[model samples]
Target: MLIGQYFQEKILSSVKCTDKGSAYAKFEWLFGKGLVTSNGQLWKDDRKLLGPSFKLQKLTGFLPYFNKHSKTLVEILTKFQHQATNVYPQLVRATMDFISESAFVQDSTYQINDEDNFLAATHMALTSFRLRLAKPWLAITPKIWDLFGLGKQDKICSQFVNQAMSEAIEKRKIALAQEQKSSSETGENHANQKAFIDVLLDSKSEKEIIGHIMTIFGAAFETTASAMNYTLFLLALNPSAQEKVHFELDSIFGGDKNRDVTLNDLSGMKYLEMCIKEALRVCPPVPVMVRKAQEDIPLDNGQIVPKGCRVVILIREILRDQEHYPDPEVFNPDRFLPDECAARHPFAYIPFAAGQRNCLGMKYALMQMKTCLAHILRRFHVSTSQKRDDISLINGMVMEPKPKLEIVLTPK
Candidate 1:
């Protein structure tokens, strides 16, 4: 599409993007208003202040949260041991609970599927949102289906979610204001749960915090759950790979359930890490990253992608590059062993993305995914349903293998 001779080159990485009205504009759209959405100094400032939260060491405190949520998730899945069912939903609920606890610590209602708490409005708004939502939400993505006229229904959905967030933000502002005043009068050091909401409330504006909480909630719950779901799927596909992970767990922890996995233990999970890397190579959570050419950047091929262009970094294509990855289609975990993997360009396999816009949830998400996998694998022998191949392959803002991810879980 960008004048490359072949499809692979065009999608892989041949040209830098610049069009505003192109698919490559999705990332720019999502982060457009906030630091994540921008490229200049605003992005720099936000990244500088918030980036340290993701550093490996600063995140150790969240391990207990991950472990606890993982145990709860495993308990839920164990209840369905005999039935052939999709595991992704279970994981979604679990990860959502974890992220919700870590973000909107004061709001119990944000956790979906709670019997007494339901966001019928949210579900209603988002369901027909793409097709029926208004122009602003639709326009949020610079590149999308504009062939059809913009619908009022779509706009309403957009308004609804925003309205919901606005209400929550207002309430949080009042609550925080009261807490601050109360603390000042009593001279009592207030307690906070350190969730994203708490993090933002400390230094940022209420409205900005609202925007960030929405973005973080979306990223934290969905991407991590997707990663965990795919990990389970890949392990189900490769039993030997799962066994190797089990072997590592056994060697490292000696089947002792009391010994919780720590950061050091994660480093010891070399093969399991490779398996995760290889799975990501095959099916990244965000398969393609979209970027806009805010300014023209020249490439090695002497092509200058002019400003205002939209670019699609087809990470799938790059990860499967025959030139970079020999036997590109195979799910070979050993391909990621330090000696084998260090030979390639780090940019070639970008599941989490590259440069400053990289995922802030990377460390937290990885911890959640890895710990859940370790716990589940340690406790049960897992296998896919007979109909796994027949599962619907649905593509959304994220790609998912639908329905029949049904796995047979037996007590180990």
Candidate 2:
């Protein structure tokens, strides 16, 4: 069986799925009825409530915040030129700060340049839990090697992340409570005072807010980081594209000054935008998405995916299909120059996935990515440390470049 299909079949086993149970009855509570893990009325309601955030108007409000954090990224990467530091890690930190600052009104934080590396530990713990959650049968046929105890490993990492996230939530709650109290007395509260979290808190219960934050991070951080990483990798490999990106930036905003590029300026950087889109097409951060059939659904192939059947959508495959993209393997930005991308199915290029379960923070994620790339290309030139023969991809919940992508940065 193919890697994707094998995983699906394992999720569709008979014991847990015996018709009465939902296709995704397990882990349903953890992920909740937001995107990526919900079904029926709850799923649709969550989708509708979150829809307003992705609209163009809402995204425009995030620019000032994006500009603030993208500058932090530039300062951090400014160090990469003299030292062969892993620039990817810096990008990860940059995106984290961007989200933490922008996602809530109360938490306007800057990078202490923590480089906490909490995420790495958290990833290990979560992956272990996910492995166990995905493959419960392992407990049935236990081996001593397995007893090397991922349990303890999980608890340690989980403790670190849980502490950090819990602290953030607690701080946010206290700040909001204070803000609300002040608003009541002064009666001078501004409408813009509410952030993304406030809107969710208003519309949904507190428990739902917790789930939304968890889902947002799970979908947001790694994807934006990967996008930034691939972008640098591509720029490093193809100096011409890198130069073109800078030229586009210069043409719109000029080469000498450091001014906040507006939506109009952002729109003018068409070529650079195309380059980002192509990079996403070739190496989408979330290359595939898995869903469980809510109920029996029929496919065009005359086969029925029963109620409990697990469905894996191979977004990468669909993107690279030669029939859809005539020269599928080529990394040409011109392919996304409106005429071409507009011709393809929206679902065909599923970078963020699609439908009711599409990524909720899609607008915010794109805003962060575009701002970072636009700012960086204008400031520094990116290139790989050594020539690479092939650009192979790493598979995980979010696909990342394998074998540490090292790039050189010189003043542009």
Candidate 3:
């Protein structure tokens, strides 16, 4: 087993680039050739330019959007009380709206009932990519996918997303210019809203702005939905854990389901955080991520990963290693306790990955999960007819629970 000598040394931090240039090539069609796809100086420059926007203080500004959208999710879940239903779409839409509000400073209007073609195109494009991933020949040759009509549909979807993003970028640029003029004339800097768009708008070109914004938007939702989905699934299967989460919420908010989740509330949610962490450990949204060795890299055990070799790290497996987590298969949040975590290797649990090229929106994603779950558990009791063994997860960029997730929620 490549366990003891390999991972314990934390060699992943040595990785400088993802295999996004190849593995996520199809994604570049929709997301533009941005940071996620670029490498070396381009990736470094983009990372440098966009880093501050995801800082803790900056992410705090996005809390209101998370809180606002979580309420909508709670309302939707309440409507489906006592019924076994798939809640993933609602979670995706909530995050979609949250991203819209936080990044575009407006609504994308991607409601459950709306015929948003852009959203449909996004779904189709991802499905096409997933299909091609399973059948590598289709992806290996662009003509093969186009011959089967998959590539055309993917392009159309990419165009739709790009067009929408382009329009949004233009509008923001004009509005920002006007705001600057107004401020200059008034001799007062009254910029009321801070958003991801503000950071993207600072980029040198419109294409650069679109690329960065789409990169942020592209990375935001599906991963978050997966995290939320598995988190809810784990909590539902383990009622003892669910009850503890409820108790924590009740104590914090005084049983007020409608209460706003402040940053302070999230900090106080120590146990809920553990539950989320443990859930991610077992069913990491991005189960496997590929990194290419830039140079000859030596492992702690006198082994070397030659340059240009592809390294795939199994995040889910490592998190469940018996050596690190006793009773590895169990859904025990206590395993993530501070003392317990400190005792383990630093790289034992990396849901968002690690090092210089880790997920940029990690802090943002965690806040969204905590805020949304806080609202959800406080307002409703979650249970599912589906057992743990019933979960059939498919490997995409994220681990998607197959068929559908049928959870029953009862309003508290």
Model 3, 1-412: lDDT tens digits are: 1333245335466644344436767677666667777777778787887777778888777788888888878887777889987888888888888887788766556655468776787688668757867888887778887899887888788678778877787777787788889889989763435577787665557777777776776677888887898899889899999999999999999978787889899999999999998888888888777677677777666877777776777777777788888888899999888898898777777788777678888888888899999999988888888887887878876788877778888888
Model 3 steric clash pairs: none
TM-scores, all models, native as reference: 0.78, 0.81, 0.93
How many clashing pairs in candidate 1? 14
Tens-digit per-residue lDDT, 1-412, candidate 2? 1223223333333223222123333333334554555555666677777767666776777788788778877877787775445677677667767766666643443355345545555466447645655566653433632576755665576566556655666777788888879989999764543566666866776556656765666667767888878877877788787788888888888675367868898778788878877888878887765565556655445666677555666778777878667777667788887888788756566687654445667667766788888888778877666544555676666685667777787787
Q: List, residue by residue over 1-412, the lDDT tens digit for candidate 1.
A: 2332133233334334312244323433222345444455555676676676566665666667667777776777778897666787677677766765555444343223554222443343335432322233555532443534434444554465566566666676777788779889999864523345555666777556655665665556666777777777778778898889889988888887546778788778888778888888877776666666666767667766667766656666677878777887677898888888789766776788765466777777777777778888888877775443565645455666755466778777
RMSD of 1: 5.3
Who wins the lDDT comparison?
Answer: 3
Candidate 3 whole-model C-alpha lDDT, 0 to 1: 0.78
Q: Which consecutive 10 residues in model 1 have the weakest lDDT in total?
A: 1-10
Q: Name the regions of candidate 2 deviating beyond 4 angstroms.
A: 1-34, 82-85, 106-110, 113-148, 156-163, 177-193, 203-207, 300-303, 385-390
After best superposition, candidate 3 residue 185: deviation in angstroms? 6.3
Per-structure clash totals for the candidates? 14, 1, 0
